[model samples]
Target chain A: MRGFPSDEELMKRCKSGDLSAFELLVLRYKDEVMNFIYHVIGDYHRAEDLCQETFIKVFENAGNYRPRERFRSWLFTIAVNLCRNELRYRARHKAASLEDLLQADPLSERFLIDRADTPDMICEKKEREEIVRRAIESLPESQRMALVLREYDSLRYDEIASALGCSVSAVKSLIHRARQNLRKVLLKAGLGEGYNAGI
Target chain B: MPGYRLKCEEVREELSAYLDGEVPIWKRGLIRWHLMRCRDCAAEAFELRMVSRALRAWGDVTAPRSVVENVMRAVRLRRRKMEEERARLIARILRIAAPVAAGVIALLWITLLPAFYLSYERGKVRPLRDELVTVRVIPQSELEQLVEGRMF
Candidate 1:
């Protein structure tokens, strides 16, 4: 029966048996969390389910919430853990779907676009994007996670270190290696000539 | 080594920090000095820079609106279910505790009621204790006297 509350206030209310407060919290974070998961897992439906599961875990454990840490960090920790579990499950099952791989193709949609650009140019860009995406996806999970936190989430290096539970130097190394791998992939995909000519 | 020629490996090591602008000033200057003279190192830097650019572009890819809404709905339902579950647990605990409390009160009443009645009955019957020989037409005084003689 009160005005809408901020996230911290909402969390307090949720702890005190306020479902509406919990729902508000869900609405606030759902999209961002989903986006994070989608990029990590490269699947919409699975990411959605994981997003739901993440909030469920958050709700179930809300009673154990300590306000000392930021709620966003806590939420991301849960989401990242879920992403790890999903990756592990896929690995153990050996069920890495080609569809999942294609979904990750940075340029897969470009192939379907009816753009008026020259086919050669479109194809070239698509190939470059695809190579970059694949290279990212193929990195060691730790490196990939660090890269994602840094590049996509716009987290500081220290923040990424905290998220990945690593040292700042380690985070730096991970991103460096990830970039190195991406560059190699891009080179193999034939962007090396023009790229080299530019510098 | 007036100007050391940068190798591909060395260039690769600095590429990440160079793109991020995280390299130390001296190291950056060194890489820059090498970039100016070493065409191979320069080319490699360019390629790596392009890769970083492409990665930044990928961040622009947005998930569909329907996907966002569906995920949110799923999250809402999950939270609602959890809330219901927590309420159920509390209700269950209360259900268990309430009857135990009531039973403890009931047990206390049952134990005390007879004891209270018996104490009241004892007070009322105390005076009658000395005069209870009417069954065989014996006088109350005679009964008391007989009992006293037997006790002495």
Candidate 2:
């Protein structure tokens, strides 16, 4: 049975100046790309801007898109590279950290926890979420990227490897190291003993 | 390292892949068996799972409407600007080329075309016998007398 046009086909049309095809590609992957940037950067507004930049870059480089490559990984590679540059720029400037970035923005309360939980539970959940975010931010860049692609995006190990420009075994090791480091951070926060019981 | 400790290290490295189901069947079984017998490995596996769950707790987010609108707007502006730049380039080239083209045509009219016509008429209309008959050389005395009359 005929299904929808694939991403490569849309990309080919985009190369031929089809705006609608480009728009469809944007709509199809924008959210996921935004979420990825948000998780990696720990800031919503920056993620939104970077998401737009990512798509614009894709459009600009449409003529260079190779059909043999997987489009999703190619897209993620662009997003990841942008995230890397943003992080490096922040670091070079000695800018505010993730916590500061979050606290400074008054309208930055987008994370939705369980509604049934009491206020205390909600606060703990928020704290736990913050810890997770900081741990992820503390990881080495490649490790954090590999872990996020694996845990958040659920990309296959091979796909993550492709996006990171590494082998599958390297991806696995990066994820393992990321998790072990997170476990250390969780343990330090006193949440290691029964963290798995229920969050 | 001790034999069992060495075994534990290898299993620890593979635990992430094992949890991800990326390991082969037989290897997965070996890791499973190792985890079953080894308390430390089991705890490590459990911690990794918890970490994965914690990361997933962030949940899915929908891209805001502004993102799409802003992207399309930016793209349209860029494309329009590119087309304008292209038009400006062509106009610039023509601005320089038009006068040069007209000058080349004028140069050909002043030089090569008349020369070509004279050469063609000489070859086609003037015979060698007629050229010999019309060869009346003017005497130097008459030329000088004509110059003196004009001067006077």
Error of 2 at A7 (Å): 0.5
Q: What is the lDDT of residue A167 in candidate 2?
A: 94
Model 1 bad stretches (over 4 Å) = A1-10, A13-35, A96-116, A196-199, B1-18, B21-47, B56-59, B79-99, B110-152
RMSD of 2: 12.1
Clashing pairs in 2: none
Tens digits of per-residue lDDT for model 2, B66-143: 899999999999999989999999999999999999999999889898889989988876686577655678899999
Which portions of model 2 miss their true places by more than 4 Å?
Answer: A1-3, A106-108, B1-6, B105-111, B122-152
**Residues A84-167, model 1: lDDT tens digits:** 999999989985564566666544464334477678866666566555566677888888877776667666676667666678
Q: After superposition, how far is residue A116 of candidate 2 from its true place, in Å?
A: 3.1
Collision count for each candidate, in order:
0, 0
Model 1: per-residue Cα lDDT over B1-152, one tens digit each: 45656566786677777767777776787788878878887776766677766665344333445544554566567768867999999999999999999999999999999999999998997778977876668899999999999999
Kindly give the stretch of ten consecutive residues in candidate 1 chain B with the minimal lDDT sum: B56-65
Model 2 residue B16 CA deviation in Å: 1.4
lDDT values, one for every candidate: 0.72, 0.85
Candidate 1, residue A29: Cα displacement in angstroms equals 4.8
